[model samples]
Target chain A: MTETAPRPTLEAVAARAGVSRATVSRVVNGGDGVRGPLVERVRRAVEELGYVPNQAARSLVTKRHDAVAVVVAEPETRVFADPFFALQLRGISKELTAHDSQLVLLLTEGRADHARVGRYLAGGHVDGALVFSLHLDDPLPELVQRAGVPTVFGGRPGWGEGTRSAVYVDSDNRGGARDAVRHLVGLGRRRIAHITGALDQTSAVDRLDGFRDVMVDAAPGLIAEGDFTPAGGERAMGELLERCPDLDAVFAANDLTASGALRVLRAQGRRVPEDVAVIGFDDMLPVAEQTDPPLTTVRQDIEEMGRLMARLLLRGLRGRGGEPGVGGTPSSVVLPTTLVRRASA
Target chain B: MTETAPRPTLEAVAARAGVSRATVSRVVNGGDGVRGPLVERVRRAVEELGYVPNQAARSLVTKRHDAVAVVVAEPETRVFADPFFALQLRGISKELTAHDSQLVLLLTEGRADHARVGRYLAGGHVDGALVFSLHLDDPLPELVQRAGVPTVFGGRPGWGEGTRSAVYVDSDNRGGARDAVRHLVGLGRRRIAHITGALDQTSAVDRLDGFRDVMVDAAPGLIAEGDFTPAGGERAMGELLERCPDLDAVFAANDLTASGALRVLRAQGRRVPEDVAVIGFDDMLPVAEQTDPPLTTVRQDIEEMGRLMARLLLRGLRGRGGEPGVGGTPSSVVLPTTLVRRASA
Candidate 1:
């Protein structure tokens, strides 16, 4: 009931501190003009009054919200379902908290919402923006850039050749995929089919390219593409089976796709590892464990990726220059992906 | 680069509109008293000059942030891994967008961070707070209440005898559990075993109580506790098997627990449905399908729960006074939970 009472104001605090409103404002703003003893006196006055500086007023002067918006260019369902997003979000939250900043999560799925989001960011609602799961030609990048707001991407944008510059943190997709396929080839499988992810994403393309690089040398005839979704994997698997009936093994772009491939293989009465060995990427723990005979897959530290993304955003917020282009200082940090060998492969 | 230029101030808009500063403020605030032609003239001037009201300056008067903080007490890994949280979050996000508000996601796992969160909410960082996955005797509710901030719990708090009231949206755990057990009993399962969620949660207690209520008449000696983690389910299953070796069926608290139970049952050489039937709750789609022999479980619309929570918070924000006990009228919305039969039971 008492909470419904009017909130305390800065003027009230200034009155209590026995100082001019301008002096109190200077102390509250952390401006250097306020002396040490006077600052301590103002602080004591603040504590006694339990006064919180109006964030809006502070933001007006500073032009900083002390908040970062993470814009996901996907549906809310996909953003929530993907472990990658969750992990990155955790990192961002943690880093922002350390700096006394708030994390604002925005999902730009529908076209109307997309425009609304663009306006919100442009209207100075947050200090900077971090974007994730971008497609080849998302207008968000250019739009935010034109607004003069510092923007970073979670992964490299799919389009634009020659040194596209946006600070990004990505996993070692290319090397990891190459290593996964090389392992399959080492097992002496000649026909290694691959289920790709959404072609519009750089992650999917890099992963597919890695698989192809190894296959072109090891086995020329075993290449296939599938969307990252499980159903996509299943459909692509069925197609691959029809096209290459004798294919001895398959590499999936992600765990969801791999799970689908495994189901299709089981449905077709193919013995796992013996008749058709299977390997999936992004060894999401639960999915990896649930698959029949488990799943042999590539493991990327999703939490670390999230943490790095947050760090990059934080560095940008602090105006720490010299980020490695679109990929960050390293251009792209390729976190090591290890193979977790299980029954399927 | 034009965006980096200082935004046009309210004073500029006032001058351009040939009006007093208060008139310009009233127009920007959408306050009553401004006439139609003047309002239209002021609006056109605002559009012409691309004048966006400074949120910080406005907040000093309004004391509202137009932001809501969503606090997840669980760790980042759990938040990301659980489909339930993600689905609920999506619902909340969608609703918040419609209300033209921002959402701040806070994960309060660490002790230091928890205190920081308490202070942040108390300091008027967010308009209101929505807490999820609260454990029994958690001091957060009391802390936030003492801070004079309106707070809502995702589920009912576990401690006390319902003396503390907070607006909550929850599934009918009792009815869902009863339905699951009753279905198994209808199928002539004499030795039914219940795998419950963590005892610290109200949902877990309600679910176990429901199972006990149905089994009290049919088969009384069938109950086991699980922490809602897959590993916890496995341990609980092992214990149940040791105590009730002839158990013919199971009703797990959640899909993860059910999956674990299924794994353990398979390892113990039990055939699903044919030999030992199983039913899990919280019908997470992918996990339900991935379970060996699949799983029959209780399905609650997680997204709807999220939407309702957001709506409740928005209502509180709008001063509509429909919220139960805390600010306005308290309503306990119990959504229906349905049973989906599959290969498991």
Candidate 2:
């Protein structure tokens, strides 16, 4: 982000007029309550220097850029390939666009980018920020917090403990996972296996917790760790099958993983929903709908979540740092998820 | 984009020092070739008014924002759903990150955004711009050209005719399509069909042109229009199959379209490669590799194209608009594509 060009400043105007900076500021800001002679002198100085009051006032006093920084702290660009990132960004972009605000997408890659993002957030270029800090140890949460800008996390921040007041918008990962597992139980699935996303992420952790909430006494062989990818799902599924060949149900962390699991199951000559049923999370459109049997998974309104995050942030910024949200401090919001039944389950 | 806050201007310092603006500029910029008394007077004035020399010089003279605008003139958010967008953006981001420049993404929606983008480019907020204007009727090319900013197009700009001097980086869509069709012909398959992408986009149009380059005067029933989506491919493939049941091979404009076509063929009990040798362009990894029998497609280096676009734009900006490329104008580059054969073809 950059300014158009250098312009005359109040300090310079005051220096030229041999007046105090405060007097120049007062005269420039409509000359309200300032002496007539002082106003005349300031006006003459401003005229000579070509000073534009609105530019300075808008940037300095009001501090409105009409731009919001969307910080994605993912190290890899693979996030772009995921429909979840796309849908969520669509939601955020639409919301911000509606508000006459520009979206400054800050794609932070690796450790070096952390400081860059931190500096950018603190640089006061954008009025506020909407960040995604999915991993448990992601430094984005702390850096953005330290930046002292009004920020809303895209998902639940994983910088655990003591930060209860952090504002966020997230899908009900635990509840959704619980519903997915319980749905399998309703189908009389006994040896139900769970394929987890990378444990480093809070969403994956919550999902695993949800699975545990239902199958408290399930065998150790029933749970397999995945990395929220098709390959990870395939590997996890293969592991679960080898350990417990009779597992009748598989619950994947996301649609991508589930798609991979589906491929593996088909390769092994198992009939989906007959010999084994599968349920994925995130109900990603093409992945879920285009799968061989289509996917029965938990539906999280990703775009809506993005829109809500922006809406919340804008609401917090409503009074321009005054009168905050409904209860003064903008609180975290957890959106509910739906179990969309399809042919797979 | 914003400034930190207003500070003392050189004009004001000159005024305070009772010297010429040029004298102040020279004194502030290291006091080179300026008289000692004038330099001392400017230095005192600068200190008194708290003016920063580098900030002014950087923003005004050199005009190095260290920021590049990536203007994606896409009305619908569906572009985000495409893996092509992800890969290209990843390439651009990585390149910009390496160059210590910020990627300021400008996602324009509908007619209103055209002027906004034009204004931003002309506003000189960024040092340069990388624009994507795929649709033939897109107003972006004209607007950006009118803005007079050094810009590089991500794809061949659709502002046809009299744009011979325009700089762009594109995959050899036509050549790639020709190769794909030629390969299908080598497989001893006649009565081949083609699934085209949305004809409005240059990539799709080029692919269609490429298909016709080989087929020449094939039956009208052999060509179907797809919107570069699996659903579109499915719809087009259904139409083609209905029109020409004896067609032995299918060439799709893109991987997404091919995926859709494959699904339709499978539902109709047609065996790929054996019954219909299927080929798709843009060998998108997961989409091409994950298909049932896998797909043999034309592989264009999308990421490399993105990197090259940035590189070209940066080259044009090398001397801050003084000197351009080797021949005074940055010439457009067209990257070659290769046929990636898998099980399907």
Candidate 3:
């Protein structure tokens, strides 16, 4: 390892290039409107001195860091255990790269990290933020609002006071759940059971609403609570079976939950689609396709949703003309979902 | 939505608090030696005015950003599709959060993005970098090396010149592969086939060497190329069966590839552990446990690897004592791997 010399500044570059400070600054900014000879000399001086532009100084002038903070508020590891967040992040990364920006990831553990995140956001280190998986009653919305940075939430946030004015991007969870239940109903299956995701998230609540939109008068024991994990799904399925053994169909909130239900059903000797039909949300090909009988699932464009979030934030940024919103709102978008029929249903 | 006010600066806080600029700076930078009354006055003024201390100005004085850049140089999306990288990132995030440092993610698509990453590291926006999934002949190592940032590669970099001095944290790929093959051999399965991940990657190459270490002089027909994707695993399985139909066991480079092989074997009516056996590296629970009859795979502590990467970098950062490495080298670490026995074999 070699020792690193102190980083060269604009003044040093100017001194080395035998040019004025303003000339060096103008050249470093873009080299536009500068003579070819002078630009070449400045470039040579910068290369010789290994002068990497100081972001702190540049940000002071430009009010931009070319960075966006992606705040994922998932305390549990199960969400990351699957590809859900990774896919969303990949989408966000692609869009940010296309726009020549960087992603600063802030993973929040719980209430303790919230203050840290709030302080970081308020510190003016980033131009905007793209937040994900915000739970009901989460203080992030209000904190971000107070910070005054442009933000786009991943899922539809739990409707609470002060969050109505917030902008977000989400999949049509309720509509997708409705379609899954409708498809099952059309298959002539009655006594349908619904497995719900963790109710803390708005997606889970909305999905439960979709399930009810179809089975409005379902039996009391037909609904089971799952935490969108295979283990949670397995336990929920067991509880549902104990309560309602005659249920002919199951609608799981997500593919992972559906997988667990399938495992338990297989263990209970209930053949899929013959004795019990199952449909799941989130086409999530890897899990959906690998199920004993390939899962019939509702497909939401997850990556597309992520891309839309970035696009929406970028649009808001442009609309504000490089200023944080002074007195206006950014519209939210809800992408649609479609049923992908497979062997299970 | 309400209009946002321009952020208040240090001068504003100083004026409002009726203190000198130096006193306000001292208060904002932690109030180490400031009087309690004066500090309280400055704090009240900052809160009342919603002042955000300029990171640019602070960094100019302290020469630190308290951020680490995590560079994932994977062009293919397959790795992200599974929980491999996600689990690793989760561990990294936990460690970084405990240290009160932020994570700045730099995902590179291909050769083009390498230059951008190089420039960013050179620009001194981050204190250190943790790079992942570097392939053979990749120029990122050289670029990062020249940038002179204290870096720790996630996996072992290709043995290129100038990379011998690089610090890294990796799993015992060869040892894990050896354990998997040994487990398969212990089951009395003759004519075992090998499914290698992308040979471009050092992990894959090392695993192949391990397989060769066990099955010295195995027939060429038993080896098939896979790009660590399920689809690639399926294709490789098909080709291996075509070349050597009697091959009784397989050692896939990763879990995703193993899942594909399991699918193909089931489709071909070859019962697992009866006529054929399968072993996979990376005991990625979602894929490993969900596979039909579960997977007998080698378990690398992925999350621990990520944690160690952050810890190693943090150690290096602290050792440098806030200076950019005045010529001291950090030792590399390679964690051990264990074979997890399950129903597949």
**Alpha-carbon local distance difference test for all models:** 0.76, 0.80, 0.83
Flag the better candidate by lDDT, 1 or 3. Answer: 3
lDDT value, candidate 3, whole model: 0.83
Q: Write the per-residue lDDT of candidate 2 for residues A77-180, one digit (tens) a residue.
A: 75575667878888988898888777767764565777667655554456788887457676666566655568888878776531346778999999999999
Could you give candidate 1's per-residue lDDT for residues A1-345 as a string of tens digits?
112324556788788888878888888877878878888888988888766665555666766666677888777767776666776777777777777766667654344466556655665557787777877766666555544566667777656431166667777888899989889889998888888898888999999889878877644345667778889999999988998899999989999999999898999999999999899888887889899979999998876776677676666655534435433232345577899999988
Worst window of 10 by summed lDDT in candidate 1 chain B: B1-10
The order of the candidates by DockQ, greatest first, is: 3, 1, 2
Ranking by TM-score: 3, 1, 2
Q: Please give the RMSD to the true structure for each candidate, in Å.
A: 6.0, 9.2, 4.4
Better of 1 and 2 by DockQ: 1
Candidate with better TM-score, 1 vs 2: 1
Best by DockQ: 3
lDDT computed for candidate 1: 0.76
Every candidate's DockQ is: 0.21, 0.10, 0.30
Clash pairs, model 2 backbone: none
Per-chain TM-score, chain A, candidate 1: 0.88
